[model samples]
Target: MADTPQNQAALALQMYLDTSASPLGSALQRAPMMNIGIDEGELATLPLVSEALTGSQRLRATHAQDLALTVDVEPDPARHALVWQMQMAQTGEQPGPRVHNFRPLHIALDGSLAPDLVIHTWRGGAQQSFFPPDAITPERHVLYPRTTAFYQDGTFTIGTHGGRSSDQYMPYMLITTADDSGGLWVALGWSGNWQARFVKPRGTSDLHLTIQIEPCDLRLPSGTTLQGPAMALGLYEGDAAVGYNALRSWLRSHMPALPSSDLSHFNTWTAMDANVDETRLLDAVEQVAGNGLHYFMLDAGWYPSPPNDFYSGVGNWRVDETKFPRGLEVVAERVRQRGMEMGLWFEPERAYHTTELATQHPEWLLRVPGREHALVNFALPDVRAYFRTFIADLVQRLGLRWLKWDFNIDPLPYWQQANDGGLAHLGHINGLWETFDWLRSTFPELTIENCASGGNRLDWALFSRAHVNFANDQYTNPDCIRRILGRMGTFLPTERLNMIYGPFQRREYDDAAWQVLEGSSFGVSEPIDNWTGQFRTSLRHHLALHRATDAYRSGHFYQLTPDTDDLCAWEGWQLHDPETGSGVLALWRSASPEEQVSLHVREIDETRSYRITDLYHQSGSQTVRGQQLIHGLTVGLARDAATLWTYHLVDGEENQ
Candidate 1:
C-alpha cells in the first residue's frame, strides 16, 4: 500500500533538533516534537525562539525560559486539505521581567515548490459597529459589519486588531497558487488578542509565515508551565471551495461532539432585553416549548437590578427575590414541565463594583486601577475555583441543560499590570481553558454556548470546548444574517452556529432568515408565549426542516458565489454530505432590485438525478438530472425575498 499523507507528514522529534541551541546551554531546546510539510516536496522546521523587536527596539522580555512544543499531522481522505498543527508552551521557575511577543511556529517555503504561488489572506473578522435598536432599518444595515471585514493581498503588510472585545478577529488565511490549484488554509486557534502577518519578501520565492501569542507577561511561580494556543494549516487542491471544505473537515475532526438530539433554542434577550421577570419568563418558556423550541433561556435581567441595564448586576449571579419570589428554580421547573430544557445567560468574566463577587473580594477583579467595571480576574486560582463550583452547583441545582456564557469587556490593560504582567495575561487565558475543562468533565450533559458579545471569541480552541457561538448580537436584519451565514460556515460548521432569528419588516424575508437558521444552531427571539396562529404554524414547518437536515451540519461547506458589497447582489452557500449524496443551499437576493439570477450549484455527481425541494418558496420538489442542476437553475426573487432549497439524489445511487 502507498504511504498515506498522514504517514508522509509525520516525523520523529529528532528530525526537528535545534542543534544550534547548544550555544544557549541547552540541547533539549528541541523539547517540542514538531513536524512539517504536506508532501516530500515541502517541509517545515521547528520554531526558532528569539527576541521580538519593533522598528529596531527589542521587546523588554526578561524572564527567559525553555520552550515546549508539540506538532501533529492528521490527513483525511475525503478532505482536500492535509492538516498540520503546532502547539507550544513556556516552562519557567521564576517571574518573567517584561511583556514580550514570542513566535512559536514558522514555515519556510522554497519558491521551487509552486512557481508563482498566490498568497491570499482575509482579515478573518470585521469589527461589529452595530446600530441601536431604535435606528431606522435601511433596506439593509452594514451587510458586512465593520468588525467582520475581509481583505486579500500579495505583499507583506500588517493587518492587526484587538481580539474579542473591540474587534472580532478571525485568524484565518488561504494560500493558493495563481491558478487556484494547490494551497493551504491556516486557522489560528487562539481566542485572545493575537496577530498574523503574511510576509513575502522582494527577492526570493520563499514565504515566511509566523504564528505567535499576544504577549508573555506572566510571572510564573517555581515549576510552573504556561501553554500557548495551537495553530492548524491544511494543504488543499483545486479552488477556494476545495480549501474551505478541507478546513471544515479538519475542524470537525478536532471538535468534540455535543448533544446530537434536538437543540433548537429560544432566547429572550433580543425580545425582552432588560425588562424581564419570573411571570414573563415562565410564560415565554411555555410558549417556546409549544412552538417546537427545545431549549428556553432567561437572558440577562434575572439578576439583581440596577434598573438601568443588565451590565450592572453581572457577577451577582443571583435571581432577584422580588422578580422571582419563588427563585429561578420555579422558571426552570416550568420549562422542564413544558418538555424543554432550560438555559441561563451569564457574563461571568465581567462585573460591576456593586456586585457580590466584586464587593466581597475586591482582589478577585482585574482592571485598570481607575476603571469602574471589574474584569473578572481569571489569574486568581481562588476565582477559577469559585466559578467551577458556582457553575457546577447552578447546573445541578436547577437541572439546567444549557448555559449561554458571554464576555463583554476588554481586560488587556488590567492583565498587563498583573503579577508578572505579560505572563499574567497568559495565565488569565489559560484559566478560562482550565475552567472549561472542569465544566466539561464534571457536567457531561450540559451544553455551553460561547458568546463574546457575539462571535468575537470564535476559534478552534474555544470551539473544541464550547458547543455553539452567537454569530452577531444585531440579529434583526435579514441582509446581515444572510451575509454572515454565507461566510461563517466556511470557518465553522453550520450546526455549531447559533443563528438568531428576529422580526424583519416583511414576513417574506422570514424564509431567508430560517434558511440561515436551518443550516445551524437555530434560535429565535419572539413573543413565544403569545404567538399568533399563523406564527405557530410557520414555526412548526421550519422546525421540521431543521430536524431532517441537521446531520449535514458536520459535512463540507462550499461558497458557491463570492460575497458582495452590492445591495442587489446575491450570496449563497452549500453544505454537502458526500456520504449521503445530499446537501442544502441557502441563496439570498439582497435588496438588489434585480428580480432573478441563474445559480450554478456544484458537487452533485452528473450521472445522478436529484429531487430539489423549495422549502420556503413552497414550490414543491422537482426531480432534475444532476447535470442540469449543476449547469443552471433559474431562481427568481420578489424584491428582498430568499429561498431554501434541499436536494438529494433520487435513486439508490446516493448510498452506492
Candidate 2:
C-alpha cells in the first residue's frame, strides 16, 4: 500500500534509464572512465572494499545451476518487532553470501501479502537455511532492479569505480562460496571490529556500484539509530540479490529525527595560551564565570589580520586591533556579563600566508590548476560559497552561539572550477558534503565542535553534524581515551560522552588528574593558564562531579574488563529506576608512576548492600557499605592523583 516494490523500483528506473542502451543503463557506458593514467586532480569516491575489486567479474561464479537461497522472518505487532533477512539469489543476482535451501519469512498482523525478510542461507561445508518456511506459507526471495536507493526523495547516488577513498579497512562486504557445485560465488570482502576478509575470486578489476549510506535517527513509534559517513558498498558483483534487495530498501526508507545529546561546554582559546597572562587571563575568567560555564572561548590570536595563509583568512573577520584592543565587543561583552557563553575560533576555510585574505584574494583558493602552491579545496563551489557567505556573516555579526570548527588541512590538488579533465574525486567528496551542508544549513545554532589534524575525520560521517567531538590528541592522552571509548561505545549513544583534551597538567602532560579521571567526564580540559589555587580547586572538583552526573553524560554501559578493573573502574547503567543505586562509578587512577598501579575491582553487585564514598573524600556520614567498604578498600595514590567515588544505596539485599 505504501506504494510497494519501491514503487516498482522507482517505476523501473524511469523505464530503464528511459533508453540509453539499457544494459543496466549501459553501466555508465561500459564503465572505465575513472581514467587510470591520471592527469587533472580531485577525484573521490573509491570503494569495492579493496584489493582492487577482489578478483573482478564481481567476485566470479554467476550461476550455471544450483545454489539459490533467500530468507525472511516476521512478527512485529506494533513493536514486538522481528524482521530478519538474508536473501540473495533469484537472479536479481549478487551470489556470494546467499547460500541455498531457505525458509524464515514469517508474516502476520493480518493484511498480509507477506513482508518478513531475515535471510541467512549458507551452502557447502555443511549447508544451512530457514527462510519463508513458516507463518502461513510465504516464499518471497525477491530482489532485482526492484527499487534501488541509497538516499531517496531528496537525492543520493554513488558508483564511482570501486570505492576506498582512504585505506580500505574492511569497509564491509564478505559473502563466500567457491568449492563449486555450480552458481553463487561472493568473496568480495572486508569487515572489522571483530574481523573478516574475502575478496578472492581471481585477479581483480573495477566493479564499483558502492552506495555505502547511513542515515537513521528514527526516534518515533519507539526507536532506531544509525549515523553518517562510514559508507562504502560501492561496487556490484557475483549476483547480489538485486544489490542486497536494494540495500535493504535503502535502509528501510532513510530514517531520520533523533539526534540530541551533547551537553556542551569545553573551553579553550582565550589567546591560544603562550603560557597565559593578563593576570592569568583575568584569573581564568573569574573562575570560568563562577562554574556555570557553557563557553568563554576566544582561541587563536583573536584575529584582526593573523591568518598569514590558511588560504588567507577570507576578508579577515575583525577583532585583532593588535590583540583585542577592547574589541570582539569587549570580550563578547565580558562573556555576556559572565553568565557564560562566548566561544570563538574559526578557520573560514584556510587562508594563511600571514593573511589579508591571503595577501589579497589569491584567486579564492583550491589549486593545482596552474599550481601556485596548492592544497585548500573544500572541493571548491566558490570555495564553498565563500564559506557560506563567511559563516553567514560571522554568525550574524558575532552574537555567535558556539563554533570551534577547525579543519587543520589535508585535501590536496583539487582545483575544480566546474571541473572536467580535472580528475574528479566524486566532485571532491561532494565538495566535502557541501561543506557540511554549509555548516548545518548555515549555522543551525552553531555547535559544530570538530577538528581534523587531531582525530583524523573520526568516522561515521563526522558524527552526523559534529555532535561535539575533539577526542584525540587525547586531551592529555589517557592511553588514547581507553581505546576510543571502548570502540566508539558499540554504536554511539549514552549521548556520546563527547571528548576534548587538556587539564591540570603542566609540561606536555600525561596526567591531568590522570587524564581527566580517565576519559569523558564530558567537556572538561584544564589549563587554568596559571590561575593557581590548585587550579581553582581542580575545576571546582570537576565541576562538582560534572553537576552530579546526568547518567555519566547520557547513560548506557558494560565493560568490566580493562585488564581487570584497577582502582574501581567497573561499569553499569540502564536504569528505569525503582530502587538500588541508579548508576555511576568512575573512581579514576589506573596507575602510571603512582605506585606502579594494581587494584582490580570486578563486577561489584556481589549481593547488593552498597554505600561507597570519597566524593572527593567525604564531609558527612560514615558511608561504608559494599560489604563494609569493598573489603576494607585501601586504594590511594598521590603523584598527580585523581579520585571520584559516589555510591549510594544505603541499604540493599534484594534480587530475588
Candidate 3:
C-alpha cells in the first residue's frame, strides 16, 4: 500500500536533515516546523513533549531575534492546506514578549506553510476539525473568530496563485525533510484559541483545535512566518459601563457625539478579583457601577476556590453559593442598577483536582494513560452538548449580559492525558470552534471575552464573538513600549482599539501609555482606584485623546513608523466628514523622549486653510495651511505624554 500521510511526514523530516544539516538538531527533534511542496513527502513531525503549556499560554510575540509564526492547516481528501509557525525565543531579559497568538502568516506550496498529515491518533487533534460562521455580531466576538483559516486547493495552485514572495522575511524556520527513500512527508501546522480544553475531556463541550509543531523544521529567512489561530492575544472589549446604553445615550449625555463607528470601545468587566465572599462580590459589582465602566467582569476565582486549579471542586463553574448567596441576580442587578452591564466568569473545561464539576463529571476530564498533564477533551460530541446547555442556561439564569470566558492553562499533555486519542491538544481546541458557534447561537445577546490569562491566548479568530482581547500585561513595567505591540497588535485591526486604554499614572505614562497603547485604546483595569497627579493627567489626556480624535476611537488608521527606539514611531487616525470633507487628526509618538516632536501629516486638502487645536494640550487653536500639516506637524509634548489635535475645517461663511 502507498505510504499513509503520517508515514510521508516522517520521511520528509529525515530528508530535511540531509539537505540542511541544521546544528539545532536536538531542538528540531523536539519542536520542529512542518512544510509541504513538490516533494509532498518532505514534512516534519514534532516529537511529543511531556510538558504542555503548563503555566501560561502564549499569544503573539516578536522580540529581538525571537520570532514565532503559526498557521492553520485544514485537512482534505486529495491534499491538505499547509500551515506553519515560527516562535522566537525570549531575547531580552525585560519580560521578552508575552505573546499569546502568532500572527496569521501566508505561504505558498514550494515547501511553504508546513507539510500536512501526522496525527497523534487520528489526524492531529480533533480540534482542527471545528469552524465558525462568517457574520459578525455580539454573538460573534471580534477577538476570537474560530473560523479564521487559510487554504490551498492544490500544489499547482500555490504557484498559480503567485508563489514565493521570496524577497520578504519568512526568516523564522523551515519545516520539511527527506526520507531515506528521498521522498518528503507532507506535514503542515496551524494554531487557534480555545474556549475549553479537551485534554481529558471536561463536561460535554466538544470543542477542539490542534497545532502540530512537527518532528523537524528548517529555518526560513528572517520575517518568515505563518498566521495561525489568534486565541493568544485576548483583549477585553465594550462595557457600556464607562457610560451605559449601547446606543448613543452616553455620547449624547457627554457632548456632540463624534460621528464615528465603534472601532474601539470594548466594554469593561471586573478583572482578576478573587472574590470568595458575597460582600466582595457585591463590592466588585458596585465598583464596576461606581466607575464609568460598562462591561463589568468577574474574573477567575469567583467559582469557589483557587482558579488555576481547574480540576479541584473549588474550580466548579457554578457560583459559590456562600459568596453569591443571592446568586448572579444580585451581581447583575447591581451592575444594571449602576447603569453598567455585567459579564460573569467560567472555566468549565478545566475541572479542578477537587471540585464537584470534576467529581460528578469525571468522564469529561481528559487523561493521557501515562501522563501527569491530564485535561478535558472537547472532541467528544457528548462533551460539546454539555457545554452548550451549561452556558445557555447560565445566560438565561443570571440575566448575564456579558461573558468573561477564560482558558488559564496551556494544554498539550492534557490531550495525551485524556487518553481518548492522546491528541487532546489537537482535539480539545475543537471546543474553541464549537464554543464559538454554540455560544453565539445560544446567547445571541451576551458578549463574550476570550481570555487566556490576559493576552496570552489573544488572537484574530476569537474576534468572531469576542469583541475584545484581554491583554492583562501582567502588571509588567508600564514603561515598556514593545509590550503593547507584542501582546495586542500582531493580528487585530483598528476596531479593537477602544478596547484598550487604561489607568495611566503620570510617573509611568512615559513608559506605560506610549508603548502600551500603540495599537489599542485607553482601557484601564483600575480606572479610579488610585488617582494622583501624573495618573490624573495621563487619564485626562487619554480621555481627551480617545474622545476627541476619530482615529484612536474610530477612524482611518495609520502606523507611521516601525516599532523601534531613536526613531519616534507614530499612529495617525483621520476622521473626515464625507460630505463636508473636514475632521480631526490624532497622533501617538513612540520615539525618543522629548518636549517637542514634529511630523508631516498626509491626506490634507492644501487649498483649504484649517484651524488646529491641541485637544488635550492646548485647548486652543492655531491657523496653519494644510500643506504644512500633511507633511507632519511639530508639536511639543510633556516628557512622555500624548497629544490630540482637532482640525476644524474653515467654515467659509463663518470665517468671512
**What TM-scores do the predictions have?**
0.82, 0.31, 0.55
Per-residue lDDT of candidate 1, residues 17-55 (tens digit): 222221211211122222322112112332233222321
Clashing residue pairs in all predictions, respectively, total 17, 75, 199
Better of 1 and 2 by lDDT: 1
How high is the lDDT of residue 258 in model 1? 83
Predictions in order: lDDT: 0.63, 0.37, 0.39
Better of 2 and 3 by lDDT: 3
Candidate 3, 1-656: lDDT as tens digits:
22122322322223223322222122222122333221122112222112113222122323233533222222111111122233333333333222332212221222121123111110110011112111010111111112212241111111000000100111112222121111112212122322211111122111122232221123223432223232110001122110111111211121211222322222333233353455655664554443344555555555666544433543366777776778867776777787766666676555555566557777777654543333555756677888787777877876776676666445544543333322344335546656765776666676665565454443223444465545443333343323333322222343342234443333245432533453454455543344345654655556445545534333223333333333344434344443444555544554545555566554468767778776544757777777777776677654444555667667452222
Which 10 consecutive residues of model 2 have the lowest summed lDDT? Answer: 102-111
Across 481-534, the per-residue lDDT of candidate 2 in tens digits comes to: 554443333223334335654544463333234334333435655665454566
Ranking by lDDT: 1, 3, 2
Candidate 1, residue 29: Cα displacement in angstroms equals: 21
> What are the C-alpha RMSDs, in order, of all predicted structures?
9.3, 21.4, 18.2
Segments of candidate 3 deviating more than 4 angstroms: 1-272, 287-291, 306-314, 368-373, 416-426, 475-477, 481-491, 497-522, 527-554, 565-593, 605-610, 648-656
